[model samples]
Target chain A: MNRQFLLNLRRGFLVTVCFFVLLGIAYPLAVTGIGQAFFSSQANGSLTKNGSTLIGQQWNGPKWFQGRPDADDPMATGGTNLGPRSKTLVKDVKEQIALLKKERITPTPDLVTTSGSGVDADIAPVDAYAQVNAVAKARGLSVAAVRHLVSTQIHPAQFGFLGSPYVDVLQLNEALRTLR
Target chain B: MGFTWTIVAMIVVLAIAWRFLGAYMVSVYEGRTRWLSYIERPIYKIAGIDPDAEQSWQRYGASLIIFSGVMLLVGYMLLRLQGHLPLNPQHLPDVGPALSWNTIVSFVTNTNWQSYSGETTMSYLSQMGTLALQNFLSAAVGIAVAVALIRGFARKNSKTIGNFWVDVIRTTLYILLPIAFIVAIIFIAQGAIQTLAGPAHIHDLLNGVRQTIPRGPVASQETIKQLGTNGGGFFNANGAMPFENPTGLTNFLSMALILCIPVSLTYVFGKMVGHIRQGAAVLAVMVIIFGSWLAIGAVAEHQANPAVAAAGLSHQPTGNMEGKEVRFGDTSSAFYNITSTQTSTGSVDSANDSYTPMGGFAAMTGMMLGEVSPGGVGSGLYTILLFAIITVFIGGLMVGRTPEYLGKKIQAREVKLAAFGVLVMPITVLILTAVAVSVHAGRAGPLNAGPHGFSEILYTFTSVTNNNGSAFAGLSSNTAFYNIIETVGLLLGRFAIMVPVLALAGGLAAKNVVPASLGTFRTDKPMFIGLLIGVIMVVGALTFFPAVSLGPIVEQLSHGKFF
Candidate 1:
């Protein structure tokens, strides 16, 4: 019984060692070599560049386009941590609304609503008609015109199944940039 | 347009390949042919560690502790040397001392709770020599523990479990390495970067601007990183970069690789234990849970927002493609969400923060459940075993017999140990998240506005404590306080469960194999499977339901009512 246990132990040990060296060391080396040979750019770190200066990767979203009011500092990329009900959020949203009016751009619902991160301090579209009217007047557009644009542009439910209609601020900004 | 179907087809093919190809490899390793003997001989000689030595569980446990401690020291030193390191042409700044220690402990534990950004803090040397090495070994440790557990079941009255060093080495070399290599080659072919040099040659785009693509040895680390379900990325953006996940195919493949080993190990467990059906039952439960999450994520992503519709944009019935790789599209993004969260692999092709509220909730819940849908390579399977034990015990109780799993009686000791292993993370995650939110340091990092903002903090804690390294990205987690708190989470999340799992293995090893009889309750039956699934759900619900209600559920309800 003792001999059998020892033999089994040896076998288990051998198998485990063999498995590790092959999987851990040799395998990683081989894969690294292969990756080096072919997918050199991506295998490195899919870094994006603008001339000699390195821009962020395309996959990482840029914070600048969503307006100056609640945009995160590019250096930090961190949130301000203000909840929707916080007085700070309300104050920031009002200031952003006033700033949008100064730009003469119609305040889209996305611009006024809070996004996933509370830092941008945007106002939600679900706010009453009065607020929409207030935002529209601030932006020098009629409430009806802003409403029509929002209604036309916002996304609806998926296959009519999930999620409510919402606008993406970045995309809206892209559209605004193209407007004559 | 057909990107979604292409992704689905790719996933199916990869799954099939892993099932068959992995089996063939294991069989080859197990065979005693003289020609194949040469392959493993050199590895045995170089390490100066005997491959054929037997070890008691105590020795195995000791080696695990010692090796992990050494790795932690090495990883910490590597981070400190980053600015002056050979591969750091970018001359990235050195990591802060406190954050470096936290990161080292995180990866050593295989919790991988990175408080520092990958692109900014780590040079190529740190990424390869330290972070990537830890990714491999930590995964090996997980596989080692799993093998020990299997031995406990397979042996009738074994005095020894297995050698920890040997298990770690073999698991890395034989299993993780080969798969990672092939996957890396494929990824490079799909435009993943692989280099030791700085920026590659510049190319002018149609817009008349120059774009110099940065290059590195990403494909190599990426392969094992995903395969091991070690979610640390070479870049801050993670797999979202075109270089890391250039095409839809690579996205699909990465997702498959993350899950492949964990899933195949189920078959391996069955083989080792001489009970294939038992493995299949566990696989079924995993598949069901994964499939449900995938469906929910897809539907939630696909649903066009009413606000977007109001703005006159075309609602693509396909899904919300915002902040997602257009090359991969929505279906693939949704699939990525499910796989990444389910497996504790944090690589992402899309911005999870951009996911819709309910969609984000599904991902968060997947992490909070401990990502045990075949969790991170080694740890995932063991956690599932904990579930299986709980499941089998309940099954036995229902049938009016003392519970037995794989010929070993499931006694109070086993139950208590397994339960402790399974419950530790949920407790730590929820409690820490509550404390963080209430404290000044924790509540200070929200980049977005609303309840979803709060969810980000909660999600970070959940991901860290569960060893599922993905973040909501909106939280500023690079602070000293977050670094310390999350590192503690990472430590407790890993060691707390691992020690208990090892103890359980020791307990099981001492037991005699019981014979199957007329009164023996078959664990493979649907009734038992249902019971097991119920136990998992009930335990999960009981542990995390209140936390969930406060974070995602409340946010979702508030969004629905207010919006």
Candidate 2:
């Protein structure tokens, strides 16, 4: 309202504009450019042959090795966030158990549980192993052969202890394509 | 054992970083180093700012407010115009009025709470121009205020703190930008997405479906989101998504980045106050509290999820894998989230709402402690100091001696300002929670039922008021009522305390150091550290015990205890 206030506003406006250009625009663009130059695959999205994603997708039927239960919308991905004592969590888990029962598969916790992001990329190695027999029987393949495929796809936690050992469903199922 | 190793590694890395970063900040604030003067000078000129000119605390506060206000306005404009903007590969529409108001206020205050799922909502231009931009500036603003407060202790009878413009500029250029750049590259190499392109569509025949996966300049924003303690994620899953945090090393690095400045500023405090021990005492207090909570949380999450157990699927060895990524496992997720919550870097690698009730309790309590266990970049340092002031006051009363800290006499004005600053967040959280629970709009927000439902609401208000930005991920909070009400909480939570803190800095700046007597309270000693921790806990417990009891505590009791 006064000259001092006016001066402050002017100064504030100019500085804000400066930062917007320098930090907001220039900095991110530079990072993007550098990322594209060096790590092009990662920067653009880690896609493999035939447009396979790094993450797992919804796999249904007894023949396909299913990933974890997932949300349909990847664009609006987030956790189910069911509390420890919620009726919703109880009901969902029960429904998942019944589905696994129909498929005649051993129920693994990861198989039943939804992820933080609806589109989780990997499942626990145990989760993968639980499906080996079910898929093997459904596909008329030897259980040993399907189990070996699952074994080959297991990615140990980085540095043996950094994260959890897991299998990428995309890689595992792709390996399954090679089996008799 | 690996989880234990993580604790040990964090200790060593943060200890090393604490000293170096602390010293670097000392140099940056003292104007002893002009590492990037080539660009800094031009920026100052462009903005009509005189770098050498000093500002009284009032002027400094006013400048900060005006600048933040301007940023909010511009950011809002960007969000509203996202559909019209250039980088809309997904072609997302513009944000609505109430959500935009909530969002800009959230970012401007350094809270980063998202009522909207980011990947579906924010365009590439909006991500870079608005969200990522604020991540740098708001964090820089935090560091500036913190350094200003450090100067309040460092200077003797000074009429001014430092130039707000110069401080903001130097922090962005010298501190945040370079680190963010280097780490952005590292994030990219570690598989974080960073491109101008839009979503990647994959036609995999697994389900005979076409998947449109979102991608953008994620690595660019992800680095600063952690480094600046701005935990706004590129994807809605935040740290959990493989594209955002693909490896264990990146997760460890993010944990380091989140704690980096908050931990170092204590050293800066010590160096500025001419007593290094003073900073160590504060750091020791932070470590004790942070470590305990991390252990409790890790142990709690290591147990099988009861929901998993109920489904007869608890045979799997990885404890509580529900709503958690396989890469991080349950224990590692607990570690990352505890670090995130403690530092006010609220990025999540797992669904916090699905944690064993105690695990959620641990995360919630960290924010409830005013996030002073080495909190968000700048806010952490000052809030802890507020605790120290109160500790000294209470300690002085117990001994019947006049209180002094860093040679400055503690009086009524300083005490009142400190008390007001300390109480602002909790009081606002309580009031907002009460209002939200009573109304249908608030009650309908939580996705879960019973006590957990109550927690979703409590956690939302607490996260907003504290400016910690992490949510329970269970609240349907995009409604107009929450948007408008939370904007009020965000503003009051941020500015209300900040004004008083600056006033205190001015008051402290005016005081002359009184020579220490035998009876003078020794704030740099072990006793002070113990009392400081005591003060923080007592304050937190007294304020939030009833509210928490209704949420996590009651949920825990209803389910029976793991311990």
- Largest lDDT belongs to which candidate? 2
How high is the lDDT of residue B317 in model 1?
Answer: 53
CAPRI-wise, candidate 1 is incorrect
Candidate 1: tens digits of C-alpha lDDT, residues B1-563: 34345445655875685468546535533432234346556655654567667677666776676666666765687788778766786678888888898788878776666577565567777777777777888887877888788777777677777777667666665666667766778877766767767655544231233334445567777877888888777766677654566555677678778888888877777777888787778777788788788888888877654333333333345455444543444666778867888887776666677676677888888877777786777677788889889888777777778889989999999999998998899889888888898999888976666676678888888888888887777688888888888887888888888878887887788789999888877877887677767777888788888877876677656632322
Model 2: CAPRI class: medium
Off by over 4 Å in 1: A1-180, B1-11, B14-18, B21-43, B200-214, B305-318, B560-563
**Candidate 2: share of reference interface contacts reproduced:** 0.75
Worst 10 contiguous positions by lDDT, candidate 1 chain B: B202-211
How far is A164's C-alpha from truth in model 2 (Å)? 1.1
lDDT of each: 0.65, 0.86
lDDT of 1 at B286: 80
Model 2 TM-score, all chains together: 0.98
lDDT of 2 by residue, B447-561 (tens): 8888888899999999988898889888988999999999888898788988888888888887788988888888878999999999999999999999999999888887632
